[model samples]
Target: MKNKKILLAVCGSVSFYKAYEIISLLKSEGADVRVMLSDGALRFANLISFEALVQNRVLSSISEDWQSGLNHINYSKNDLIIIAPASANTINKIAHGVADNVFLQTILASTCPKLIAPAANNNMLENFTTKNSLEILSKNGYDICEPVSKILACGDLGKGALADPQIIVEMAKRTLNQDNFYKGKKVVVTGGATTEKIDDVRGITNFSSGKMAKALADAFYYAGAELTFISSNEFSAPYPIIKFSSSEELLNAINSQNLSQNDLLVMCAAVSDYKPKTKFNGKMKKSQNELNLELVLNTDILKSLNLNCKKIGFKMEMDRALAKQNAINMLNSKNLNAVCLNVLDEKIKFGSDQTKIDFITPNGEFDTGFDTKPNIAQKITELAKQI
Candidate 1:
């Protein structure tokens, strides 16, 4: 990690003082640190103090040194850039690509992964515009370190305080170590089943409990990827989650973002393959005799994600031959990196806590015998590292 360079950008916020502690903590962890401050940041902290602490010059503006032709581009080349106490205004600028200041300019020019810790007044943080901007930034692959809820300097008690410096340092360390194999990668995981609404509350869905998807998300997160867990309303993960209720909604959410080469899309959702052709305005009444429901094909999430980004799909089969064939077919048909095949005969899938999986990649196939979800997740992360 010492070989990796880190750029710490400070913005104008009462939490600016905490940024100093962050710099020292990162330096202690063997990272080469450089400091960049927004013009407003200097009001709270002095450049001299930053320089003395990092033993490097504090960069404030493009005009600070004409000898350096483009400071923003040079600073942007670091391995990981973090903006501690990122003001609401600065966060908005970053989301919209408004490079009005040196900090924003460097962020715009940066190709490395970014982590932002936003600190603002409670009202500003909860504002609709700020919320939308944060969503945009998240979709664009930014790791948002959630702020803590505490008494604000403005005499309000709510969210918007900078997270603990220790947490910030840990996140920065993870982001700096690209050789750790999965650092800074964005992974979109689809989990659970989409509910096709029949009425205001009634719907048709599946039995998928999203356990596999949640496992995958947790594994990917531990592997250092900025994960987006896209799931149906029935599924929930212990990490950052994005929920959807229908196939159309899930499709729209996936299509709304621009995924790059480094991004990995995991289509683990057991989406409903069929849905009612027509939804009823009210709940269907009890049937007197045998009733038939017409079903229509729902959107194929795996195929769509395959077209969008590098994808990993899952197939559950009852027969070994069919499982292998389906895995190979998915690899060829969808151009996936790999397919995780599960045989349902073991009864260790779906809502089960344990699973046995056969991994079929472009190079070969391997099986991980009945194991706990955590172990399965570890194996998946290992495979991802190889990729």
Candidate 2:
């Protein structure tokens, strides 16, 4: 939770007061908390008190930021959104995609992981409409933290009070554990330059140092994705590595994994485009100055792989004007789900820590400005979640 972002959407309910305790609990866990209060909640919720803990203005219907709906869109990008003290009104609206208030609008706008913790009077919670809304939300992928039997603020004992703040925090943890986009997803990454041996001591390779591969691997690991690293070069990681020295070995390594359409693969390796027409098993005598060797095309791993899973390729471009078009062409021609385009000494270069890349897909292109490899890798990881 050290750097995790949490969005707490509070609805108008007697349990609204408990959002403070929940915020305190989450802060104790080191989470970065942002609060969004519904119009109904504004009556009981004091803006000044919330501002002290959130360190920002609480999102509300009256906020000027909602004019273009930008605030809701941006705030919804958090790692997790929790509707604590979810009232019957909010719960029903959420189930049906009705966006009357800021909270409901943000819920509809976000595809990130979310939790709905319903809190209302016992009769309100038991109504057929309320019960059905809760069911619909649960079936639609929102985690529902069912209320526990407790003494209500109205002097009645029932199972409709907002769950204990501690329980809501724990449920938040469990929700993130299960719904983090990359969590438990399988990902295969290819790196290093593929080699083609002309002789035992003479081989061909590219300028790839596999630095980006390590960075990506680290990013995916932190993101909770199950990882498989494929490379000819050695690198240290906590995940398993399947080593290969040639295009054939690399293909075999990929094919051996039994990957499926649900998995993801990133082709960052600078594989040789051509190989020697005739490879020599033994070292040749100092080849004559006029020595000649025929070259032939190597297998197109990206196109030839027998995979249905989403695949992303790295396209290296030497010209800026043609870079984006080239990447789009590669995306289509190579049958890739997306392509990351890097131009030599411009957007990206060999052996550099930082990079600027354009993420191109059939939909469009997203240009990531100059940034560290790790930061770029994290951005790519986010894109991977969608693709």
Candidate 3:
């Protein structure tokens, strides 16, 4: 652990005092630690405290003198970067690529893994703006540690407490070790909502956050797989990813690749089923509120791959009764080794961190209760090993 360099960014919150404890914990674990504090964070906890705890310079702004030319670039060069007690404003800034401050600048410059433990008022954390920002950050490959429900500093009881220091430290360690699993084998993951274009600027799409696909890719990487992630526009993956925007583009990407029988293909993309029959050369002019549009069915990429190679497919459904039956039918029809079935009714299918899935095979079905997407991917990979 001592060989692992960790850059800790402290943000403003009543829980900012706990940041010192985190520093001490990480140091005890023998991790090389550097500390950066946000301007608002310094109000709750002074820079002197962090310097004493980590025995390193505490950076607060870009103007701070350092041995390196740009502290942000230097700070970004670490194995892992974590922001504990992340304020709503801080998260927003990071999501938007705002580099006005040292913390945001370092985050923007960072290629290393990032983890954010939010610590703010429950209302603030739950606000639509904050949630959207977090979604964007997660889609961009940031690990979010959800705050615990506890008594607030303002005397309110709800979810907004910083996660336990131990939990945060362990998560950081796991993230750093993610590369160890990808030593061999080939893995492929598809992500994002593939557009079935209706016109020059319009199309049909689904609400695929690409989190599940990203998680699957991350898991395969950690499980010793040479990873090739094919995604649309979503970008929450922390690996070399290939991008595509349409169903045809995705199909072409898959078909053009030289895939082997030993390779594992996880079809997690929510591709559109149909496209417009007539594509306008330019943006369609607005006339009547109601207009008829001719549609054509898009190629089923997963089904096509299923016929030629062994693959894992995903089925997102709302009805439980239909899910198992549909999963089994799809598995057999598509010649899949296994299918992961999930329900969108509980909001587990998209735009959320936690999810529940049922793993289905021809012989039996296994219920994997609600869990983090990473853990679910782990379970899926383990199950794949059995087959």
Q: What TM-score would each prediction reach against the true structure?
A: 0.58, 0.55, 0.57
Quantify all predictions' global Cα lDDT against the true fold.
Answer: 0.80, 0.83, 0.81
The whole-model C-alpha lDDT of candidate 1 against the native structure comes to 0.80
Residue-wise C-alpha lDDT for candidate 2, range 1-387, written one tens digit per residue: 666899899988988889999999989988999899889998887777888987866777766385654478877888999999899988988888898766777889988888889898899999999999999988888878889788899988998988878768866765675437776678889888888999988887889888887777767765767788998788755567889888889988887776678788888888999999998888888757788889999998987788778899998878789888878888989889889888887546788999887888888778888999888988898887667
Model 1 bad stretches (over 4 Å) = 1-145, 150-155, 158-179, 233-239, 287-290, 305-308
Name the candidate, 1 or 2, with the larger lDDT value.
2
Which portions of model 2 show Cα errors greater than 4 Å?
Answer: 1-179
Candidate whose TM-score is highest: 1
lDDT of the structure predicted as candidate 3: 0.81
Q: Please give the RMSD to the true structure for each candidate, in Å.
A: 10.3, 13.5, 15.1
What is candidate 1's lDDT per residue for 1-387, written digit by digit as tens?
465698899999998999889988888878889999998898887888988998877788734564764377778888888999899999888888898777788889999988889999978988998999999998997878889899999999999899988878766654543335666678888888888987667788878888888888767775777778888745333346778889888888887656787688878877777888888777777767876778888877666652456778888777776778877987888778888888886567568989988888888977888898767976887776555
Scored against the true structure, residue 5 in model 1 reaches a CA lDDT of: 90
lDDT of 3 by residue, 11-78 (tens): 88888878878888888979989899888887777777778877777777734766654377777898
| Number of residue pairs clashing in candidate 3, backbone atoms closer than 3 angstroms, sequence gap of 3 or more or interchain | 4
Query: What is the TM-score of candidate 2?
Result: 0.55
